[model samples]
Target chain A: EADIYQTPRYLVIGTGKKITLECSQTMGHDKMYWYQQDPGMELHLIHYSYGVNSTEKGDLSSESTVSRIRTEHFPLTLESARPSHTSQYLCASSAMDRNTEAFFGQGTRLTVV
Target chain B: AQSVAQPEDQVNVAEGNPLTVKCTYSVSGNPYLFWYVQYPNRGLQFLLKYITGDNLVKGSYGFEAEFNKSQTSFHLKKPSALVSDSALYFCAVRAKAAGNKLTFGGGTRVLVKP
Candidate 1:
């Protein structure tokens, strides 16, 4: 199993609320990513961090922002939540400089009520 | 841009029978392909990956994938189906141009009958 962990496996909140998804890894990987997946849909890359102090937007445009202050932590924050933001957010990590296996944490299933 | 495609959205196979999940990809340069399986309400588990060299690669739980350069396809195959294998399977690829950020397909639901 992956050493990565995501807090609040399930979350239900009202619209327009500020929230954050926690993603932590113990493997000290340089590459971390966030993918948003709707039911029976493709997983779209939302955000990623190459290392501490480095973040980049992914293929899919998202309103969320991410921070990588530590090597093991890459947290995504939403300035304002909407119903459309509800989906499974998966966190994954992989070693950089080579093609390595990616480890994934149990996704956080968010619901906007 | 690099992309992967899973032709079958869902595949059902009889228990003990062989099964295959199709995947095709397009990349500008060298391709790194991977397969992952997800059970209900669980995290995705790495099944296998094809980086270079050998066309056929084996992975965890007796899963294997064959990389075909001419076809630009990497199809996952299992000699026998298991009920436990029922889950969503995703085909992912990372193009040389895009670094190692993986792009996933829509995924395929594999159901094995008893």
Candidate 2:
């Protein structure tokens, strides 16, 4: 099993509340990503980081922002949560080499009401 | 940009039967293909990947994928399906020309009935 972990395996909160979904990996991977997924649906990349201090927005437009202060930590923050923001967020990481496969976390299922 | 497609939304199969999941990809240069499986309320687990070499690559859980360069297809297969094989399967593609950014398909739900 991969050493990556996502906090709050499941979360339910009221709208307008600020929330941060934590993702950390112990494998010292250089590439980390955050993907949004609906139940039994496709995965949409929202944020990714090549390494510490290097972050980029993914193909999808997301209200959330992410930071990579530490190589093992890539946390995503939403300024104000909304019902629309409710979804399963997955965290993944991979080695620097392009040929390697990525390891994923258990994912965090968030619900905003 | 690199992209992947899984035409089927779901694939139904009976246990102990052969299984196949179709996947096609589009990329600017050589393609890197991958297959991942996800159980309910869990993250995706890597099943296999095709970077180079043989067209047929075997992976975990008796899963395998065949890469057809001419068709731009990488289809996953399993000789004998099991009830535990029921899950969501995703096909992804990445290209060196596209900065190696991985792109995933819409996903295919596999239901292996016993």
Best by TM-score: 2
Clashing pairs in 1: none
The TM-scores, one per candidate, come to 0.98, 0.99
Residue A39 lDDT (model 1): 77
Residues B17-55, candidate 2: write the lDDT tens digits.
999999999999888889999998899999999999999
The CAPRI category of model 1 is: medium
Per-prediction DockQ comes to 0.75, 0.91
Summarize candidate 1's per-residue lDDT along A1-113 as a digit string, tens digits. 78999988999999999999999999989999999988766799999888999999999999999999999999999888999999999999999954687899999998988
Per-residue lDDT of model 2, residues A19-92, tens digit only: 99999999999999999997658899999999999999999999999999999999999999999999999999
lDDT per residue (tens digit) for residues B38-103 in model 1: 998887899999999999999988899999999999999999989999999999998769767889
The CA lDDT at A59 in model 2 is 94
- iRMSD per prediction, in order: 1.4, 0.6
Span of 10 residues, lowest total lDDT, candidate 1 chain B: B93-102
lDDT of 1 at A33: 95
lDDT of 1 at B97: 92
lDDT of 2: 0.95
